[model samples]
Target chain A: MHVGIVTQTYQAKIYVTLRPSVLDPAGTAVQTGFKQLGYDNVGPIRIGKYIELTVSADDEDAASQQVDRMCDQLLANPVIENYRFDLQLAPTAGAAK
Target chain B: MHVGIVTQTYQAKIYVTLRPSVLDPAGTAVQTGFKQLGYDNVGPIRIGKYIELTVSADDEDAASQQVDRMCDQLLANPVIENYRFDLQLAPTAGAAK
Candidate 1:
């Protein structure tokens, strides 16, 4: 008897943000822009990166681990930033590709 | 009797991404970096912006509306990007200020 192992595709949405102690000049600039545009009620904006990608793996745990490694290696700078991600099973169309 | 209208504070996390049809050079560059670092399994990476800010409003709906307006006015580029946001009640520490 022959068995087949099908790899599942997971979609990951990763958010990388600066550590609270880090200064965010871009965010501060945007806050100033908001005030100039009459959005005076807006307060204390901090900016970060949002990344979306797909990974094919044997299971959800494997996919999550791979994503974590990727973040540590390249997606985020640990000294100045932190990252969190959400993973979902990719749609059938995406999996087929 | 004085009727008090205390404004509630909401924290908003906004994501702005390029439309699928638009080309993303930065994403492609990052993908190449991932491949060079031996993460060849990664696929179709896209990079975007994540913004966190606080808004003071009368209620949840009011907060949502204000955020949507902010996105249209200054946070996102309507021509080639799409935006979405999640709103939560600010913590007691944040709301107190």
Candidate 2:
């Protein structure tokens, strides 16, 4: 027997980064800090941001599908940044998001 | 033969996420979006942030050391979030960060 009273919920996490061809001023600053610390071997770096989404969907595939669309439409700038995400299901409402 | 004029630089990327015990309002909003979209199976989610650094260090260990300190002191709130980082060396300055 299936319980139709409640549906499944999922959690999604996304990571976004600047494209290799772009500049990262923040990353450069971090490099400079290492130099000042006398550890002058740090390499060039790129900076990025992360986003997490809590969604109600039929399943993982559907949740991923919706979030992917979200990423394409507003989360990442395809011309300058690249992104990846992960999704997991939650069985309880106590899992705060 | 060695040139003391320049030091090696390393690129660092860090991901910061809240502890399971913490609350995430931003993630919750994402979940509600799914509910409104008619896909009421999405679960609770956790939100986090990312950071990247271009550092000049003597070696990977050294860069990691300094960055670890930076995370502890500024990048993450240990009481609510956890962090991890990755580092790579670059041979040329053209690798913008």
Candidate 3:
């Protein structure tokens, strides 16, 4: 593994969520916690997964396409989970704060 | 157990991360994937969890304190994980896009 070097790449953030029609037990449990806390005005909650990845691609469109492939193949379950992403130029290692 | 009612509340987003000293196998695994994909310039990768919730609070400070307490109590493991959050006056339910 290489270290201490920065390279130009694409940064992708993928959010995976259950289909709206599907029940999210964990989300309901959190909402219940709010209910018990007397946050009666609090709204619906959905628990989902967020993934950040860096990949080699020429441009945003290319990076997004690759990320979509990755999501479809392994990152998200198409049967119940839907995924969307945002992309930007990758920052150097240790640059994020 | 009410549904379809939009209310004014505080929206909180919590990001939980492993301490810098802690080894993150999942993150390493993803880094390896990038290595195999020839993204040698791709930098360090860290994987963490993101959580969102709505709560009743008089203001942002109140909402943040409640979220901090929740993080300390049950939302995150203070021993090896660090947590931070962002808060905003909540938009109506289903307003997120």
Write the residue-wise lDDT of candidate 1 on A1-97 in tens digits.
8747667789999999999999999999999999998877888999999999998887889999999999999999999999999999888524633
| lDDT digits (tens) for residues B25-62 of candidate 1 | 99999899988988767789999999999988878899
In model 3, which regions exceed 4 Å deviation?
A1-7, A31-43, A93-97, B1-7, B28-45, B93-97
Instruction: Report the number of the highest-lDDT candidate.
Output: 1
List model 2 lDDT by residue over B1-97, tens digit each. Answer: 9855444567677888888888887778765765676545445656677876666665668768888987887668899999998877745643433
Minimum summed lDDT over a 10-residue window in model 3 chain A is located at: A88-97
Candidate 3 lDDT over residue span A22-94, tens digit each: 8889888877886686556556677777677677655567767777877787667999989888988876533
Candidates 1 and 3 compared by TM-score, better number? 1
What TM value does chain A in model 2 reach? 0.80
The residue ranges of model 1 lying beyond 4 angstroms of the native Cα positions read A1-3, A93-97, B1-3, B93-97
Candidate 2 lands at a TM-score of: 0.63
If ranked by DockQ, best first, what sequence of candidates would result?
1, 2, 3
In candidate 1, which residue pairs get closer than 3 Å at backbone N, Cα or C atoms, i.e. clash?
Answer: none
What interface RMSD does every candidate have?
A: 1.4, 4.5, 5.2
TM-score of each: 0.92, 0.63, 0.70
**Which CAPRI quality tier does the interface of model 2 achieve?**
acceptable
lDDT by residue (tens digit), candidate 3, B22-54: 888887887677668654644456677667778
- Which 10-residue window in model 2 chain B sums to the lowest lDDT? B88-97
lDDT for model 3: 0.72
